[model samples]
Target: MKNKNVINYFKQVHADKVEYNKQMARLKELPSDYQVVYKEVQKFLWEFTAGDGMDMLPPMLELLDFFEEGAANNIPVLQLVGEDVGSFAENTLHEMQAKTRINELKRKMNERIAKKISKE
Candidate 1:
């Protein structure tokens, strides 16, 4: 069952990747300024993936949160692309928040388990 859940998670991640690419293409159809920002974001993501240094998850989440807030508030560039882009940002933010919460929960659980083992 645990293995099945892992498999399903990977399958969902694959599907999300396909949709993410399509959305990125749509974003590229926006004005030049928006395209530039998108390209920078892509570069940041690539570097985050390729780098072999300390984890940058917190900063990456902060960046996403900034964009999400901008889109939700209808900031100029985000508004130019209309509601679809805003919605995408909102969804991404929610997903990231959920993942963060899950990670926190996992960390706590591991700590508790370790303490229990130490006491045994």
Candidate 2:
């Protein structure tokens, strides 16, 4: 019975994740301000999760901060629905750094090739 409950709980969590993703998609489509978006997201988290949702707030706020900053800078915010914001941010930064490193390596290779061609 305990095992059954655990499985059911996880199933519910998955369903909630899907619903949250759908809600997020719709929210992104509407015109919104930071506070409004924050509240809506907070409410959604509280509604879906069994816990108090406080643990999730910090990361959610971080993501909201990113959204606000992106909007101010005229940069597009990456929409990551149903993801942990801290993990998402960490992963995104790593991906960006990797891309930068790749580009730098490519530039160096091209420069070396150019120099060799010039010598020839």
Candidate 3:
């Protein structure tokens, strides 16, 4: 059973890697403005990434898809994401329900504060 689990893990990893490569290739085909904005937004998202960072992959992929669509529709990247890019990035994180380092810190801080108060 353990051996089967190991094989499945490797297989899933391989599939994910392949999909990521295809996404990257599609990203490259987008307009220059879209490419730049997408990369910047992606980098911003990773800044708050937690755990092994695998939690970020889905959101990143979704962002890439949006960018690709914007490019296809000839829409300006800035218009799609709005002037406040960081806000857009935060919104994306919320929309995806992805956990980040900030979320972890918030949880820990609240828990510790509650514990301290309860002991009083």
Candidate 4:
């Protein structure tokens, strides 16, 4: 029962992420004029959530930021961000650090559980 609950919870979380990814992909295909609105929204999001961590922008927002920068720099509006997008080095570094920390915690938890089982 507990395992089923955990599986269902993870499936729901994954489903939400998949939906968000689809939305982001669709947003990426818009014309330059429409992209500006999305870029503005991304900028506002960063400002609202920044809290002194400029390096810690969300991954999707980082992509949007890249697109906005390209637009500012005279890149064609219809070009895919990947072709025109600049580096996400800083954001990638921060995200990788965060992922490492999460993985470390998971490893520690598993070790602790194994030790407990051995003791039993």
lDDT of each: 0.53, 0.52, 0.83, 0.54
Would you estimate the TM-scores of all the predictions?
A: 0.38, 0.33, 0.78, 0.33
Model 1, CA-based lDDT: 0.53
Model 4 TM-score is 0.33
Deviating ranges (above 4 Å) for candidate 4:
27-57, 65-91, 95-97, 101-120
By lDDT, who's the top model here? 3
Model 3 spans with C-alpha error above 4 angstroms? 1-15
> Per-residue lDDT of 21-76 in model 4, one digit per residue for the tens?
77577666656564765555455434423323332234555555656576657776
Give me the overall lDDT of model 2. 0.52
Q: Model 2 segments beyond 4 Å from truth?
A: 32-120
Worst 10-residue lDDT window, candidate 4: 81-90
- The candidate with the higher lDDT, 3 or 4, is 3
lDDT per residue as tens, model 1, 14-98: 7666655665565545556656655555454434232231133444445545555565565776554354664544444444433
Q: Return the candidate ranking by lDDT, descending.
A: 3, 4, 1, 2
Candidate 2: residue 24 Cα off by (Å): 0.4
